[model samples]
Target: MRIHTLDLRFQGIPGLIASYLVESGGEFALIETGPGSTLAALRSAIRAVDVDESAIKKVFVTHIHLDHAGAAGWWAQQGATVYCHPNAARHLIDSSKLIDSARLIYAEKMDSLWGDMLPAPAERLIVLQDNEGVPLGEVEINAWDTPGHARHHHAFVLGDVCFTGDVAGMRLEHSSYLSVTASPPQFDPVAYVQSVDRLMAAKFKTLYLTHFGAVSDVAAHLANYRQRITEVYERVAAGFREGISTEENRRRYAAAEHQAAMQAGVSEELWLKGESANVTSMCADGVRLYCEKQP
Candidate 1:
């Protein structure tokens, strides 16, 4: 199987958003579709690999976040099957609720930020359950229910490589380090940690992160993700306990995250872009979820 990295540039961030294409047998599979506006990039990626756009047989979205599964309906229209965790199936089949919620968040910039996020026809949507196996010729991907970032998340294992949507967080191209950004309302620190532990137990050495490209030394990456995410969550949770406001937490965490990325040698521009591109907002959401779940 051949895995191609498709960087969906400037979808929201100048260089942060991305997706992946995996081709096996005579057909192709897309692990994530970036966003609705990323249709051109997706086609470009397939063409770069010499695969016809119509040959894309399946699209396995780890979750329904706009940046991950936004272009699925488009792919389905192109004759591809859309597969996702059960909870996310409804959103894919009827995106009205999801679009409405996103509208409230993005307000005037919805189309520019995400493009037209239409629903995939129900007939084309395939709901994947945990432990389900999807065979793409000689290679097979077993979807594991990996939640935390979102309840409707899945981590796919294909041979030695694991396609971890946000389960693995963001690891940029040039950086030798990894960072964690747990977004809110859907971010569950405890669940995220548990999910990481589950991934670690899978014993795969190479992890395919959605942010940019591949990361080997899975132990090191997961360690850093867990350690940093834990620290950031602790800081945010403490702030919440002390009656600190959500906006204040967002501001402070954003600064700390940016500095850490800089120290890791990310370019000043990419660092700033990654820090601000809904990452901190998601972190704030994660912190809020943690606080709400606290007894």
Candidate 2:
């Protein structure tokens, strides 16, 4: 199987988001659809490679985040099969709750941040069970229940590569620094760490992340990712103990992370882009929600 990454140019940033196109024996599958805002770019990219966008028979996403599977409905409208976790199948097929949830996060900027998300036809939706395998040409794509970034999240193990959505955290192409993506309502730090450990225990040659590109150093990247997620939660937890507002906690968390990135020698350019892709404001809500759920 040959895998190619297409830059969605999210929020006008080239490497902030990516969608993978996998082909085997003339059959093609699109892993992540990015957001509806980049549906046109995705089509143009596929066409530039001489493959018709409509020829993608199987469309799979690691999760239902706008940055991951936001454009699945658009592809389904084009005659493609949309596959996602059963927990999220209804949301994607209807998308009324999806849009409503986005309103909570993006507010008036929802449309600007992530264009329209039309419902995927109900007949085209396929729900994936954990550990179930679906044929992707010559390879069998296996799904793992990875519920850290979201309860409905799944990581696909295809041949030698693992298409880990937010379960593996964020890292852009230009730099090697790993950032957390603790988005609102469903972020679980304990589960996030365990999921990273699970990915490490699984035998995979490389990890293809939705936030950006692929990472060959699987062990090193995941170890650092687990440690960082813990640290970010501890930092946020301290703010909660102090009785600080969520907004104030987010401010402190972002500043601390920015300083740590500077000390670690991450470039200013990618740091800015990476943060925009997964900001502390969202992470703050995620941490707070998890903290409240804890004893």
Candidate 3:
């Protein structure tokens, strides 16, 4: 089995998002279809590798987040079976509700940021329950119900490697700084931490992050990510406890993130790319909302 990491070059920025193409027994299975805005890039990447679109018979998404599975329907239209968590299946079949909710968050930039989300045929959309496995030629892709990044999130395991969507957080290649991508409406720090623990217990030899690329040091990477999640959640939680306004909290969070990135020796260019990919404001809002619901 071979896994190819296809960089989507989101917003023309490399390392911001990726899609993994797994090959086994001459058949291809794709994991993650970066937002529709980068559909052209994905096609180009596939062609560059000399694989036809029809060769990709199965498409597995970690979640239905625009950045992760926005272009899934496009692949389904090409005759691929789209696999996702049960909670995310209906949304992919009829993306109106999904688009509406995303518009509320992205507002005017929605079109340029994510592009149009084409809905897959209901028959083409296959919902995978927790612990279900899908056969792809000689290999089996196992799905684990790994939530916290979003309730609809799943981490797929292929042998010893795990494809962790957003549940594992965002880590730019070569950067030691790992940022939490706790987006709004479903970000639960408690569940997020638990999901991280679950991944840790599984002890995968490598992790394929949808945000960027592969991580070989699974244990350390996950340990660091788990710590970063708590740090971020506490930072936002503290701000709410102190009665700080959401905007102020966002500013402080962004500033702290900048400082941390600099301290970690992340280049200004890479830091900016990471910031654009996972906005600190959204992270702050997610944590703040989680805190608000607490007694």
Candidate No. with top TM-score: 3
* Candidate number with the higher TM-score (2 or 3): 3
lDDT for each residue of candidate 2 in 1-295, tens digit (9 for 90 to 100): 8899988888777888888999987789999898888888888888888888768988998888888888889888888898889898887888888889888878988887888787899998889898898887788888889998999999988877899988988886635577888988898888888888889898679999888789998888898899999999998888888899977988888888888777778878767877789987778878988887788
Supply candidate 2's per-residue lDDT for 73.
Answer: 90
Error of 2 at 81 (Å): 1.0
Residue 220 lDDT in candidate 3: 95
- Where is model 2 more than 4 Å wrong at Cα? none
Task: State the TM-score for model 1.
Answer: 0.94
List the lowest-lDDT window of 10 residues for candidate 1. Answer: 9-18
Whole-model lDDT for model 3 versus the true structure?
0.91
Model 1 scores what on Cα lDDT?
Answer: 0.80
Q: How far is candidate 3 from the true structure (C-alpha RMSD, Å)?
A: 1.0
TM-score of each: 0.94, 0.96, 0.98
Model 2 worst lDDT window (10 residues): 170-179
- By lDDT rank, best first, the candidates go 3, 2, 1
